[model samples]
Each structure stands twice: as C-alpha cells, then as structure tokens.
Target: MEDIMRGRFSRSMITVAVAAAAVSAVLSVSITRTLGQAPAARPARVGGKPNFSGIWQANNEANWDLQAHAALPAAVTQPGIYPYDYARVPAAPVLALGAAGAVPGSLGVVQGDGQIPYKPEALLIKKQNAEHWIDRDPELKCYLPGIPRAMYMPYPFQITQGTDKIHIAYEFSNTARTIHLDKVAGPPDDTWMGHSVGRWDGDTLVVDVLICATHNLLKLFRFGWSPQRA
Candidate 1:
C-alpha cells in the first residue's frame, strides 16, 4: 500500500473510535447502580436441595478482551490464518480524536466501550480479526461460540436442576445441555458443551466439562481443509 493510503486508513480508525464513545456514555448513565429490589430467601425442600433461579450476572473480562481499554497501538494488522479477504474488512472513514472519542475497531467501542487494549501481539491478532469479522467470526458460522464467546452472547440462558437431571438452555440457536445427575457412568463421546457433570456443595453449583472444541458447530466438524480455503 502507498504511504498516503496507510495514513488514510489509520486516521479513519481513530475517527470511528471517537464517535462511538460519545453515544455509549449516554446509554450507561441510564442504568441504576443496582437492582431496586431483591427476592426473599426460601426454605429448602424435603431433600434439603435449594432452588437456583433469578437474574444473575457472570462478571469476567472474557467478553471484552479486545476492547479492554481505549488506546492507540504500536501497530494493528490482520491475523494470517483466518479466511476472507482482508481488503474487504469494514472500517469507517477517518475523523477527529477526543478523550471522549469512541475507540476505533468494532463491536465493543462506545465511550466506555473504547478499544479492547489487547496485549501487543493479541491486538495485532485481533486487528487482523477486525478485518474480516463479518465472515470469519466463528459465532456467525454456527460454531461452538467458544469459551467466553458463549458466555457473553446477547441472549440469556437458564440452568435448572432436578434430582436426576440438570438442564442448561442457551438463548442462541436455542442450544441446550442436559446432564445426567444420576451418573449413568459410560464411556465418553464428543458433544458441544462436551459432557457435563454437576453437583451442589452448599450454595455453589459445580460443572465439569470435557471433549469440546470450537464455539461454532460448522468449523469443529472438519478434520482437514484445503490450504486455499483457509
């Protein structure tokens, strides 16, 4: 690429991040610090098992690894192995930068939604990700939605436990997992969430998983691939 074109693209990224930040600030202020009310505790059933239900949040940075903070990088480039045409990646045209400016890139940028501030190398990898996110994002292809990916999906899921079974329902694609609480005790087979084993210890719910790969189903099924296809 010519020096002039590189400058234009870099500037464009800055502008995009700035504008997104302003709008995000407004949206955050509207939320109350905490829920206004809490439910009263209920007594345990005959078996002394407690019911686990109600709104809960899983707090983790896994969702925003790429958008941890708003900061300019030493360099931002696309990943090498991902599919899709790099030139086709989406980037808004250039504009001004402000402390309140929206961080450039995609998905997580707003005011507080600034750049993900990935480690230097990770940022470069994700920068490559930015280039083809529309097509290459595994979630879009119906893949497993990977760790942290599945956790942060826009939809809500529920977990229900019974004496013999435990059920988890995912909002995306209506994906669900059913665990045999009775311990069928059989040889392992591969599945999306792999096989889950669950038990309760006082107030905590324990989940054990294995043999899972990929967040989207389409990709994990493939054992081999063409070089060009990648």
Candidate 2:
C-alpha cells in the first residue's frame, strides 16, 4: 500500500510540473509573436535627406506684431453707428464686427532684451509702417511674403521633398518656394520670394535664401514634430 501511495504522489508532482511548463511555453510564444508583429519604427531619412514632408504652420501672434503687445484696441476706428453710448462713439471696425475679428494677446518670439535693435531712421520707418499698416503693409497688397515671414504666417505650408529638390507650398496666397539640393547659381532676378539653396547640417536643414541684395539664413530642426502633425 505504501509503495502504491509513493508512486501516485510522484506521478501527481510530475503532472503538475509538465502542465506548468506547457503554460509557460505557450505564454512565451504568444509574447514573441506579439512583439514581432508590432509596427516598425519610422525611417530616418527620405531620399538621402531628412524628411520634411508634412503640413507645417506657426501658431502665434507674430503675424499681428513681432514684438509682445497688450490686447489693446485697434489702432484704426470709425465713428460708431450705434447711438446708444456716446463714450463708445469711436469704435474699431473689429469691435463693430464683434468677436470674430478680435486679436488674441501673445508674447514675442524675438530673443534677448525684448526689443528690436533698429537704427533711428529704421525705427522711424517701422513706426510709420505700424501707423499706416492698413495701407503700407505688403501683405495687405497681396505682395509675396518672403522667407521668415512665409514660414510663420499663421497658415499651413506643405513640404514635398525629393532626392535633388524640395518644394514648399504655402496656403496663404498660394505662395511656393523650391530648394535645389544640387549646386546652382543664385536667382537670375531678385524677387520678393527669393532663391533658396538647401543642404543638410547633420540633421537640420539649412537653407540660405537670397532676396534682392539681402541674404536670409534659415535652419529647420525637428522637421515633423508639430502638435498638429503629431
């Protein structure tokens, strides 16, 4: 009887061990299959360069004023048509139109002392530009918005990149710019949109733009990490 009991106990222990091992093996195989089937990571490059293929935009009040500004009343206004309040006789067209045209307050993107370093004459010109912005602003006249302005115009822009060329198309005014990766001469004529030559500095896309006699340098890092895109 004792011998039979010992044999039965040993058999039970072996059965439990075998069952546990089988369960563990099944679990290990399941985990391996799940991990293997996971989506692959995004590629590092597209067409031998950093991929900048996406719709990009800037979300800030820089379009209104490059410098920090309080939410003050509009600079220009006409006599209010409403006769209810004499104190509010001079009201901006934006106010008359209601909240749709209200300007949101924002801090400046300019680094350092929060002031643009301009010569006296240049400062005077800037003031005049602001004072008569309705008429003097190039954007109001449908002029081509150049380099930095185009990049941050509170509108969407798309980048289509190839091995030897990159095309940037903007939503505002249907503005577009092409960047040649191959060696090429500057633009034949100085235009508002300018000419761009692009190269890769490590991971950043460095573009040197020449407009008229002025040279504007731009560096784009983290090509597709915008909140809207992400």
**Top model number, TM-score:** 2
RMSD of 2: 15.9
Off by over 4 Å in 1: 1-46, 54-62, 71-132, 146-148, 185-188, 214-230
TM-score of 1: 0.44
Whole-model lDDT per candidate? 0.48, 0.64
Over 11-95, each residue of candidate 2 has an lDDT whose tens digit, in order, gives 9999999999999999999999998896756456886667887778998877766778655345333445565333233244345
**For model 1, how does the per-residue alpha-carbon lDDT over 156-217 read when each residue is reduced to its tens digit?**
77866577776767777767766665676633644555555667777666766544543332
Each candidate's TM vs. the true structure?
Answer: 0.44, 0.61
Error of 1 at 221 (Å): 18
